[model samples]
Target: MSAGRDDDAQGAGAPGDAARPKVSSVLFLCGMNAIRSPIAEALARSLLPPTVYIASAGVRHGERDPFVDAVLEERGLSLGEREPQRYEDLEDGFFDLIVTMAPEAHHAALDATGTASVQVEFWPMPDPSVVTGSRDQILDAYRDLLGRIEQRIRQRFEA
Candidate 1:
């Protein structure tokens, strides 16, 4: 993965025509932080306003994904030195919302945020790393995943 400075520029959230709740902080979670969740964290951090704190974790820690870096690089986003971490490894300890990309992470977030004010949402996303085929085919899988997550973010935050 290539290294680049984290983009701190604020992004437009919901448009003036749409109505959505204000979310100050968000956490994206997946079975392993390697792929989905990290992609989400990077996208959200760039796609949402700077006021929205963004982070990601997994049910279990895993190595950072090169595909994730590749896919994001296509959009001019870079992962830099960010590393994969488990849910327990987050230092902030709380988020206004938790978006889980896999069943395991969803359950973990639910259990971890039990009875708390934080909202947990399950976004069942396929793991692109599981794809098998030519390099281009595998990359297609990642591109598809990235599009889906981007669409979700727009709908939920930008309407």
Candidate 2:
């Protein structure tokens, strides 16, 4: 995969709009930090406001899947700061918004983070781990997830 930067995917409006407090830094939650949440983090951090932080966590803890690294490398975001931390590891009500990549995580984040005070978005994403077939088949699902995240992040910031 080409490892450079995903900033080109943005419109001229990105830099100006990423500063919106309605969006701000986001926390992406999933069943695991392995796939969906990680992809969301990578895409959002790269395409949104450079100062706007993006982070991922799981309802349950697990190792950071290597596929997440490979996919994000293609999009040019460093995985160095992503340490597979759980939501409880951070303070509550810290993020301006929370994005749940799966329904299970939506429920979990609802319970764990008490998101009623903050914006919570449920994306209902499928687990990329369940993908079967060739490598491209797997990469395609990941790329598709990235596309969806990019769109949503743009919406939260620009619209």
Candidate 3:
């Protein structure tokens, strides 16, 4: 565990622990996953219990967005081989909390994790694609979006 925070594997402690359920696995979702979802997953790993496995996927299985890689690089993290997967392709009964960063993702994650009784939270965040500029300029948007995702995860998951 890092000095400032506890990893999710040993998270601060889930609420209602008299008979607290197992540490919830987390699935971060987005439209294409080349961005928001992956960032959220990384941030979750840093803040939540280490045992809380995290995964991410997209609604449409679009091409891997370069911006997602760039954004994570700011924190010295890389999305190297983490290819994006369409929601329809995910295996069954895997995660406990499905976090949707895009509107479409909420429906998908719900349908995917809903049957498993997992919790779902929707976070309406901006798309780095909307950011128009040079390569460097666009990457800056990724950085900003990454910061937002990181901040939100910290607020909601950290104790």
C-alpha RMSD by candidate, in order: 8.9, 8.8, 7.6
Which of candidates 1 and 2 is the stronger one according to TM-score?
Answer: 1
Candidate 1 is scored at a TM of 0.86
Residues 1-159, model 1: lDDT tens digits: 112111111222224423335779989889989999888888888889998899998888699888889899999998899889989988897887788888888778777776776766677789899899998999999999999889788866873
The residue-by-residue lDDT of candidate 3 on 82-133, one tens digit each, is: 7888767878546666677887887666555534555566777799888887
Best candidate, TM-score-wise? 1
For residues 1-30, write the lDDT of model 2, one tens digit per residue: 112111122321244654334555788888
Candidate whose lDDT is highest? 1
Backbone Cα, N, C clashes tallied per candidate: 0, 0, 8
Clashing pairs in 1: none
TM-score of each: 0.86, 0.76, 0.78
Q: Which prediction has more favorable TM-score, 1 or 3?
A: 1
Candidate 1 ranges with C-alpha deviation above 4 Å: 1-20
Name the weakest run of 10 consecutive residues (lDDT summed) in model 2: 1-10
Q: What is the lDDT of residue 13 in candidate 3?
A: 32
